[model samples]
Target: MLTLTENASTIVKTLAAQAPGSDDTGLRISSTNEEHTAFSVGVADAPEPMDLVVESEGARVFLEPGAAVALDDKVLDATLDDRGSVSFAIGLAE
Candidate 1:
């Protein structure tokens, strides 16, 4: 399960809109053990393995099984800065 904020909502829309033609596109949020700390956006030629499709008010998030583990019980969100740009964050429940 996951939650989407307004800022995340906007980013989701932008990514979807960026897809080629009318092709369906959405956000894929994952947690990796690799030493990388950033989100990614791209077009997939086909469905990915162990991917969970999440949707909220026209926004979507694709999560891999392994990544979902770290995201479990965590609130996935996106927030806007003073510059009006958006960024993503995850919060674990206390």
Candidate 2:
């Protein structure tokens, strides 16, 4: 299963909380291509029926099948730039 770093967990929680509807809203990741080398991220009110739900440290991430497989042994991390922009990255889990 994919894991979230502390930075990623905090950032995801903040961003997801901004959505107006469900408290279960979370960050969603999906593969951009068949190779699963690229991913797109967004806030979703709920996971798709087939999505894999990953929760850590109060944060939740929904992953499509390809993305879930691709990221299975990875870690999600984030950083907030000086201008308030957030960037997300993936790394191998040790």
lDDT of 1 by residue, 1-94 (tens): 6667666777777767777644447777655555334445443422367887767778767776656655656666677779966677777655
Superpose all Cα atoms of candidate 2 onto the true structure and report the RMSD in Å to 1 decimal: 0.5
lDDT by residue (11-69, candidate 2, tens digit) is 99999988886988999999999999999999999999999999999999999999999
| TM-score of every candidate | 0.69, 0.98
C-alpha lDDT of all candidate models, in order:
0.65, 0.97
- Residue clash pairs of candidate 2: none
lDDT of 1 at 7: 69
Candidate closest to the true structure, highest TM-score = 2
